[model samples]
Target: MSKLKVQWADQHEFHALLRRSEVEDKPVLLDLHSPECSGCVNHDRNIYSDPDIARDVMEYTFPVRVVTTDPDRASTDIINNHIYIWSPTIQLLAPDQTRHHEWNGAPRRTRLSVGYQTVFHDTPGHLTPDAFKAQFLVARGKAALRNKKYGKAIGLFDEAITRHPDDRVTVEEVSRWRKVAQDGGVIESTWDHQHQVTTSPLAAAVERFAQTVATLPDNVLMQDWIGKPGTGDWQWYSDCLREVVLQAYQELCNFAVTAERERARHGPRFNDTHRLLGQHRFAYREFQSLFIGVPDALLDQTPLRSERSIRENLAHMVMAEWWAYRPQILHALDRGRKGLPPQVVPATDTVAQHGEPPGSHESLHELLALYERLHLRNTQDFSGITDNELGIRSAWWELGPVELRFRLERYIWHPRDHAVSIDKILDASGHRHTANHRFAARLFSGLETAEAALIGTDGFLAGRVDSLMTTINERADEAARLLSQVTDIKPGIG
Candidate 1:
């Protein structure tokens, strides 16, 4: 048997090497990865195991392995949290653990194509020692800029820039990233900012929706939302159901957050979140179609307490979402009281039982009053959530300790998903809604795929609540403002 030849850096020695790189202005190869990562496993199997790569690795820099596991607790922690969202992340640290150039998960081509210089993600193939040295010099040079060693670092970086002279990686991209590192004394690639912004996944849909519906008068159906019975083949309507475009996304984030609260939730770390936004886009598309020319017949549809009014449907959506989490909320409430409210609060209205109607029956004030109660219920339940619930196995179900947060979020999003359809039906008759069904289906399918991609990973959701919640509040204001603008127009009772 050929004697096994393995080069390993001891823990203390590894740290020392990293520290030296920082002080001495040297570059080091620091691989921060986990054994369990599928991506990491692939990289190891395909690249690290290569004999040529092993031989060549020695020439570039010190190769150290930092094991990021928690055997003592058998659970995830802060650093693990980082790994969960940003798996197999490669960082060029200044021996001192100061990050220099990091390969973000950005689609290199898409990132570079944008106007601003972006630190594009690089999937570096395991290279021979010589090649490794070349890249290391460049990466290390970038890390060295913090100590006012611009010229020295430039030499390394410039070589790298030359090696890939015809490559798409731009000078602006490298310069901008270098500046970020210098300012912070350790560079966190701009890719992090992009990921953070794209975290919600739903925000993109909302932004697009806002752009689509910015000029609607009263209702898209040209009727007052307060009076119509809310109905339209929403499933067959636009791809994005307006209410759920963001609401569903909010639910998705909340679900991931609540399910993994004890852990961290990376904002839709996968593509599933993006797909959800894509479905939402269809809903906005339908909204745009209804008001493009403001059909005279549809203008009469008022917000009066009608079965079909969007206001009622949105209000109902609020309650539906509230009801979904009611059991858990009540369970929390009952923990302190001798007796608690009922878990399931189904609506008794005949119209509600068969799904809300399309005509008006209640005043806006009365409907809002109902919505207020639902909102109150939702907030109370969330605020009362506990660490025990977050950290331990849930007792909410028997099949398995299911993630309660994800379930609760489904309810939040379901209404919004359907809301898009209802809004379309309100704006036009069955005609527009029917014509757009196929498009909606295609988009909805895209959303499901996106949700699965994003939600399937170890990414977290709780982290995105603030921005998402802010958007909902803003949409509510916008919707309210649209109604006010229409109050002055003569009611076109068709």
Candidate 2:
């Protein structure tokens, strides 16, 4: 048995390690220590050095050490984010760098010398090798659960129970989390085992708001808004506020679509894959609405210089799915059937072969029909895809490597992306907004006012912010109800 090797890293290397963790599909084990702390020294020399403990850590996580006292060697962001006061802290972080579990201080036991006698004493933190192993197992299991690796999560939880039955604290946590995994990882509502039930109108909107907030990238969320309101730096806050409102509008549209799904004859089952597929159908419906009152002649004319005409963009959307995305999904499904772990495969170059403009002979109606057919075929291909199988990665021309879930999302959004461009063309040609679109815009304008006020206040008054969120939620629910009613309205092109 060999002792654990310590790999110390600075803040810059910590970011690289996080990227490495994502690519390798593993959590990061962060060990923070101070130079003057004896417990920190003992942890390095005693607990981590143990062979069994070292092996378990190495197998489950990407371990990195940081010295909290040294600016050159430490990650101040980690310290500030976690708000640690203890000398030695251990944190288990997911691939996205969100903390899963953390514990502070040092091992519970320490060797002591009293004259001629050697004794052992209890410390502030419990860091025995057995306890530490249980912690790693439970933390890793939670990370797996978050990543939607339900089977693997349950297996890890069971192993934690079987191996460390006497570790009561860890065992209790694993037992609770194992049930969550067993229940297909849907823990939001008790009414349905598969679907989350929003108990009230307020609850539904709040839920949508939370979901939308989660999708914002770290760069947007982590912007530095230094100084007071109306100052030079206040523009950062204003920019962030605008982005939030735009995202909220998009999410409200999605929320309304989902509400329609619940009322449909064949609703999505309580799983990510099915829900995504259902959303694709809703997206197609939304995309179809964009063409209302548009002339066929408009489809052949390019909206901007160096841009494809609406007809060409529609053709590319259909062909990309058939030639590029569909093949990757099939390859991933095949690998899943063969019981192999997901790997990055080469990208299909659909653009290279199908780069030519669509002929003027093709009508808008024909292109729409072709797209619908492709959607149905792709849906059939993804009929039995499991959540675990969705993790399979394939190469994307723009995104490098992406998961099946992302591909499914692209399947939904690719048409929507083109639809946005088409909408621009329609606007330039003096097309008017429908009643539903106009109503949604009014609701969004009201919601944007509330959101901007909340952002300007800097959330200092938590109670006031809570009240404003309630107002936003009520407005969101109203928007959802109104949008769902107009979903079936179809206007003819005159």
Candidate 3:
């Protein structure tokens, strides 16, 4: 049998692939594997190596291979409760990125000590090629059910059951889901009443915030409350507080609405630093796409009405990101951690002073390599900086004194701004080789400054608010339960 001829993607390319899947209306076949796992090895040898099975998979799904070696990527919730905790875990996701079906080939092992002896147990073995193909059919059936194609879904499930009747595990699963399709495909709720109760506090808190915003003075809402304190007029503190609260509330709601989708895409442990880094990476990816097939001659050739060429624009972004913005935030963090006062300094001019650093005018590959090095250094340096340090103010060029959080938001948008300029340059020069491949770029627009303000006030409340509310609700419930358990007796009776 020939080896599989399908394109494989890792976590880095997963988001783009998801977008493609959505646009193409195809399910995603996700293979969570580990090199060290025997079951994974067996699957590779027996299942993926078969040409017929590989062709069938490629024809129906967008296949992605996620390696379990990287903890950061593997620990993420790719689908609901479908984290990569074990090797050879296969999942098929609908176009909306919801889990349609999943199969864990082997059980995760842990040594259990009982009376000075250790014992281990294993679950089912890897699927045979025929069984594996049956599982794919079941996955397709689930996706069809989700799309309300009841007849199609029932037929698919029946086919899987008929074609691989010996695959007991898959047959049982498909049988249950087939009946579900027969009954109009209603997915049962997996969450309990406790989950519902615990999550209500977040919605209540959000509503309270909305009501509070409604009570604020109309004039206060219109004022420029983001200005540096002590520079504004009387009642400045109160007005700024109103604006801050409103922005925080808005950010909180926005975050709540998209929290699950964002977590599914970028993991659940995202901090301010991670968010900034993700945005930077996204911008660089876009930049790479724009410059991929452009001729070497166009790199140095400035576009009409534009002062800088595509190469110059990219070079400036890389230089400024590393030299100017990174240093400002890192210095502020250092000072804040050391309990030293904010320092005032003239900002270094990256454009006039640096001019195009060496290797920028070389090949596009070299320039990107240079930028990647700088980005890596920045990532390493800023990895340990916490949300608490974001409020530390530093005097920045022209913008005057601003919080480190503001600097971070600026860092995210800076490369994107340059990327837009470079895109225009490419447009002007008619280098649209990769134009059709571009997806809609996510933009912060003008919300970055407002969001930074919220961060400076409360250390990025949006990330923690949901969990905080859940904890509060859980505690309250526990207290109520305890009180109910305490028997109340009359003075003379028990």
Task: Give the number of the best model, judged by TM-score.
Answer: 2
Candidate 3: the clashing residue pairs are none
lDDT of 1 by residue, 291-346 (tens): 22222223223332212334335444443444324544345345424333223222
Candidate 2 vs 3: which has more TM-score: 2
Cα lDDT of all candidates, in order?
0.39, 0.54, 0.53
Top-scoring candidate (lDDT): 2
Evaluated at residue 451, the lDDT of candidate 2 is 30
lDDT of 2 by residue, 141-236 (tens): 878887889999999899989999998667667866788789887542111111212332333354343322322223333343221222244334
Ranking by TM-score: 2, 3, 1
Q: Which sequence of candidate numbers ranks them by lDDT, best first? A: 2, 3, 1
Q: List where candidate 1 sits over 4 angstroms from the true fold.
A: 1-6, 33-60, 67-84, 104-137, 166-172, 175-494
lDDT of 3 by residue, 1-494 (tens): 74567667776776677788878878888876667656677878878888887888889888887665433533344421343211226777655544566553332321122311111222234467887788778878878876789999899989998898988666666766787689885443211111111112453332223222222333334444433332134234424534344334344445544543445565444467656655554555455445433445466544454144665566566656765676667766777788887663322233234332332213444565567677756765765667677778865443346787777777778777887788778888776642112210111111222222222122334546556444324423432343234355111110
TM-score of 3: 0.34
The total number of steric clashes, by the backbone 3 Å criterion, in model 3 comes to 0
